[model samples]
Target: MNFARTKEEQDRLEQIGELAVRFSERAGKIDEAGDFPYENMEDLKKAGYTTWTLDKEFGGKGISLYEFLLYQEKIAEGDGSTALAIGWHMGTMMDLSTRRPWNQNVWKEVVEKVKKGALINTAATEPQTGSPTRGGLPQTTAVFENGQWVINGRKTHTTLSPVLDFILVKAYIPQRKKVGIFLIPKETKGVSVEETWNTISMRGTGSHDLLLKDVRIDEKYFVETVDPVNNQSAGWLLHIPACYLGIAGAARNYALRFSTEYSPNSIEGTISDLPNIRHLIGQMELELLQARTFMYAIAEKWDRSESKVELQAALGAVKHVAVNASIRVVDAAMRIAGSKSLFFENPLQRYYRDIRAGLHNPPMDDAVIAMLAQKALDGIQN
Candidate 1:
């Protein structure tokens, strides 16, 4: 299958690359202020990036998964937080387009809104529930009443809520014995935002708590039952790895720059001249290549209509490799840079913090290890 980007997609990627460079320059300040990267998002929107994965039927470019991941990696290399935040939007759009059981009318309306630049996000995580895994079984519920659904619950880690036009909320329908997704408008009644995101890394992501007390949604906004297991492969699962990949790349680039410029008084030469420094850089490069190769391979496979079950296992492995590599790369950067890397003003510290967030993502270390062990045992039995 052809993996090369069409000329139009290539031009769009170049534009996104430019935006990423500018966003990177301001990322440190945004993290220090713990403010949302509104300006950066606007730039992304202007570049048609917000709709990068939207369906072509909806007047979007509808780029394949492989192309999308490549673009994500480039943007991430520029600014991890900005890429991390926007990744959710792209993933959300992909799910809405390809996975969520939306009817024709609902799809038409949502597609129209998306064409108008509406941003969607998943408000699935909660304070009581650590991750969306073990079932997104919400402490929240939506009751049907007066020709609409009334939603009530507190959702934590609702990333990008500040700028979201609509949120895809998971809530249980008591009478139906079903959990469904509701497209709740941000301006809906009883929807409130709580400034609860105080983190050492990815501060610019604006992952705050959402208090939904009697947030009403029209019946037309309800989508069909979402398969809990199948949701894992719907493109959004790639975002966590993409974020860490970007962070790892940034850390590697910084180390290279530091080695070439900084001259230690005792060494009597730049660190770049040292064999040890070159060795570390080589190791970092190897890890980056391995992680990226695994990620893009799965993406390419998916784009070619591969089986979801097999890809799910591969996705878990990719996350483990990418996140682990990110941690090692950042650690090496700090050690090579010495005391200067610890300063709050330096980007390395932020990379260190942001990479840790991947540890909390789904298909976590323990789960991935168990899955791999089970697969190995199954192979032995076979």
Candidate 2:
């Protein structure tokens, strides 16, 4: 099912997949303790995954979107929380490398840091407004003071904030009344993580509160104007669906293995021989097949196409369909596992809980449905 185009791409994915397998050995324990998977991040860096998506001109692998999505799925197979958290950095860095908005010196430093395995994430969510993608203005304020931009605000759900070397803050200048993103180094004064992430799903991700009180940085740190009205096709977000699909794949594999081996005294053969269990396995296979087909096909198309259609609706649908399918597949796997799936040590329960969290991620279910309805109505009017 992999679509790696080059030997280098194949070798890179194989290396990442190997690291992901090692990471999986600790995934359950990490979840139970609710701690960030710092080891997993470090392992990925050592495998050169951090620079896989960076442009070749920057002394990196420069993998394509299709290849990146495939590796993301591989990583999720080992640990979903880590996959989701780091995908933000991987995708954003790839996006920024080409269409950089900041000065060359600033961009050059960022590229160097990334090459050296530095993690970065956009801190756009706020306690007041939630995800900035919904067209809500950020309450975080920035002001120019003595050749420096002083920022004061708090952001919620800042995933991987603890390990991040650079934090991109979306803020408004009070004096100019203009909104823009300001980059803040982790060591900048008055910048800290508030240690507030405690969740049932994706608990290994340190998506805590990022607090910045009068965080001062050079004025050149302000970079990239986020325009909600004229956003380009977000093909990078395909990683979201890929991660969940990988989780579902793990659950499916577990169920299959258990069914083949487990036998009760009352049963003449393994549960896998039962018609109902076979039916459930068939169903899970179909779900994964459909999800993988859509995600990879669209990803490859995005890479090869010169121009892309309006992708907001497609991106929303991709997340909605793939996540829901993964959730359903996990549920089926649990049913096949019967009571064993409920055990604390079983991976099925973890998969079930982790997949549920994707329902709350950005491009929410309601927004996707609303967009579909509007598009349908507009088609009728036309």
Candidate 3:
């Protein structure tokens, strides 16, 4: 709700909002057919929105976390699946702008590729180990052979698998006893997607399994070796909550529209004038208002933060509140629409399923709670 802080920001958001409206037109079809939003992504690419987070020098808008979340939230209002699918590439690129874990020239080249509409996302989750954020060592292996690195492993949750120009694969280097990030081109030999993503939710994401069967690339593809778990918090991850918040916003819009128009002979005027419907509408707004405040406050802090460690607790807490609050908002929206919301043709049902996908995203609720508890205990001890 009016997220832009300046005139320029408002203009940018309005432009993206237009794109979101276009994407929303097909969201229902995509979700019902469980098809990838390739056309939606093409729209983003043609509009040059895909490179918004890259630095100005890299031919990008170089927006901050606050601005990125604003744009992402707007996009999700159109299509949550599309928002989530692109969020990985957008957030990863934003995070890399600061982390700079790869060789300087190599990273610059990759950014150039991104500027040219090439897409990228990290393929880290695995069937056996779960999300990489959980500190699970990747079963994927990288071996040096014939003067090149050969990678072998299957990655689950490889979002944008259908059209990712390049995949940043997390693989354990047995010889080095460390994990390395390998850049494997989608067209690389022995690389393939299994098309196994059949989840009932976020179906448009095309998050299939990325299978690498001895896919070999030169040494230059070895971007960097990193610890299995990164202690540093990432501000770009605010995109997750931002997307869910947008979904909630969409639900709120639908419920409000329904309440005002869907009047029965049993009631005077419309349901919007009814006290119980009014109560649900007010509660939904209240929930969204609280969640939005928390998300944006932390986002601004993250943008201005000088230390990652200091923002760790806030990072998790924002995601926790935003995701759970978005769920409540959608539930209330469904209630207002009554059984019609459950109809296969209703967009509300799609919103309902897509919003729940946030719960399984990174920074799970249990981990956030544990971290907050530890922070409280440490504060008391000190």
Model 3 C-alpha RMSD to native: 0.9
How well does candidate 2 score on lDDT at residue 63?
Answer: 80
lDDT assessment of candidate 2: 0.87
- Per-residue C-alpha lDDT of model 1 across residues 135-240, encoded as one tens digit per residue: 6577788899989899999999888988998888987788787788898889988999999999987898889999999888889888767655454555557877
The number of the candidate with the highest lDDT is 3
Which pairs in model 1 have colliding backbones?
none
Candidate 2 regions off by >4 Å?
1-8, 228-231, 380-382
The candidate with the higher lDDT, 1 or 2, is 2
Model 1 stretches with alpha carbons more than 4 Å out: 1-10, 227-232, 380-382
Between candidates 2 and 3, the one scoring higher on TM-score is 3
* Cα RMSD for predicted model 1: 2.3
User: Per lDDT, what order, best first?
Assistant: 3, 2, 1
Write model 2 residue lDDT over 36-122, tens digit each, in one string.
999999988887888888889988878888898989988999899999998999998877875666888998898898888999998
lDDT of 3 by residue, 225-344 (tens): 888777468888889999999999999999999999998999789999999999999999999999998898899888887876788989999999999999999999999999999998
| Pairs of residues at least 3 apart in sequence or in different chains that clash in candidate 2 | none
Please report the candidate that would top TM-score against the real structure. Answer: 3
Cα lDDT of model 3 overall? 0.92
